[model samples]
Target: MDKKEDKHKVAEEPMEHTLDCMSRLETMSDEEWNEFFSDKNSMSDCSFLLGYKEAKLRKEAIKPNAEKAWQHFHTSYIVPETTRRHMGIWIYPLATIAAILAIVFILKFVHLNSSDIDVSRPFMAFTADHAPQLITITEDGSRPNIIEGRQQRDGILINDKEADFTHASFAKKMIRSIATPRGKSYKIILNDGTMVLLNAESKLIFPTSFVGKQRNVRLIGEAYFKVKHDTAHPFIVQTEKVNTRVLGTEFNLRAYPTSDTHVTLISGSVIVCNRSNNKAIKLCPGQDATLLGNKDFDITTVDTDYYVQWKDGYFYFDDLPLVEVMKELGRWYNVDIEICDNSLLSYRLHFIAERQASIDQVVENLNGFSYLSATRQGQKIIISKKMHLKSD
Candidate 1:
């Protein structure tokens, strides 16, 4: 977007050439090619890199000697000789070098002004030193970010070399809760080779890996975990209010900052515990544990799928209160849900959709039984109690 940056953008050229650059390079001898492309550091200087690249669309199009193709490639973009040099090479009889350069410059500039960017270029790489370039992603209506390798490098800490993290296996010991922001998730392969998916606005930080005896991962927000079976070490998920321990199993934890934590076990044995008095309750398949942030915590045996559906494409609700259902909806829909009608808060519904679904679809589906209307004013989507008529 700046003048300095604009100088580096490649000017496009017509792709109607009958001869292929790669084929021509392939026909040349390897020795000649090696001598030509030995040191190609000026790649950014010659602006035809993208144009030369498009000229060799696919690998199959290169039918000439490999060396010749490489030499042409290196020469055309890497280290091009002026037209004066071309004149000495028994070509282009009395053509002025200045005229040829001007023509090339005009053509490339005009082409670039008329076309879109060449997306084939791996924008995340630098050709000069083969460095991996930093990528910045600023999705619409979200925070702008410059992150690398999923983790944003904290500039001050990295520059000062002050940050330190101890590597420990996640087993047995007590782990505190953790959380993440929107448009973010974490992938952690446990010490026992179990995988955990920490969803957005969630956090789970325990031992560096897994150590001691049991596999433990603290949970805050929501997460879907696959525990690895080990006779010696059992896996556990700890929350601010409850603790979930298991050996080999799959389960989900929903504990947002504004709501009570819910532990739903799907396919294996688990124990949900109270942190205050160390009270423990073992759970089997089709079981659910609810821990309020206040004091009282309850457990019941219901259709576990109803609780675990959010982990999949389904958002299932079975006789759930409106406040509770609104919490779950808030997480997946990435919106702050407000309940204006206390009378309608007791209504419950069951529905399923992929995580990337529109908020309108969710509202329309859940409002099938009641009169609920929604309107978006900026980032906030307001849901109000309305009457469901014969038609939408």
Candidate 2:
């Protein structure tokens, strides 16, 4: 064989073991992963395994050129004259290491361009179906940090350790935002001991530390708030259509951009005032007040359980319209629901199911209703009216 052929050779045994080690790592716990990589004897194995994983993940996205990768490895090292004489024996491992280096460079380029937040942007917008993000906005700019898989803390703890954030300047008028993408939810405790459970597709923007008299927060989606009772400082939740002010209370506020603003009081009294007309309504326990867009509130008594079931991992629908029911299901499943027949939109549904149930199971239960027909297509659900024969 020519010298060129020997230089490009690869060791099949190491390549095969790389795949096996990655498969085992997939099922390992944090401690197991650390222990596996800490062994000095396995240092070489760990490097190759990590490089292979990164390359494999970005294979389609990067579409790296084999010629370029080989060229990179070729220029990075010089084989000594003595080593050239035994090139066939050692060239394979050297060639493999060169390829891994190329893969790492491709990943680094992608990270700098896409994942890292730009210093000029005010906030980072995350896409659907990903983990929640905790963003901090300072006078300089904004930095979006993934709540999961991050070690550094900036002065906030999510669920006592699942995620952490801490920065010395966090106390000084710093703004923090917690955003949860579709099909995901997050619970965070504020500096004032108030607990907030953010629903899917929601964003809560607040200060890292409560300053001034009132503890204020702006919500762009749904969240269940259990405010800490401090009569001196009233807790205020601002939304697009209305502002909910309470001294101390437990309530769920749903303020999705596309949906009507709803403030359902579970315990404690809250005054919800319309942003447009400044009209206000005081909500008692078990009362739901919906902003009707004309600065009017449609206040009614409701089963408080129906409003909070999402917080507790349940989908509880009590005499809710079929369209509204489908909307809730769509948010949780990250699927789009289309009513094939417009008439089915007004059909009232009384259903209760666990959020953990498979989408197929939930769809099957919906199909059990005599007047409803439901079918699931990849990432979309079609609901139509079921035809029934009249008795002769």
- The number of clashing residue pairs in each candidate reads 23, 8
What TM-score does each of the candidates earn?
Answer: 0.51, 0.61
Question: Roughly what TM-score does model 2 have, to 2 decimal places?
Answer: 0.61
TM-score of 1: 0.51
Every candidate's lDDT: 0.52, 0.68
Highest lDDT: which candidate? 2
**Tens-place lDDT digits, model 2, residues 241-292:** 8999998899999998767788999998999999898999899999999887
Candidate 1 per-residue C-alpha lDDT over 157-195 given as tens digits, one digit per residue, 9 for 90 to 100: 111111112233233443333334553454555434676
How far out, in Å, is residue 300 in model 1?
1.4
Off by over 4 Å in 2: 1-143, 150-152, 159-171, 387-392
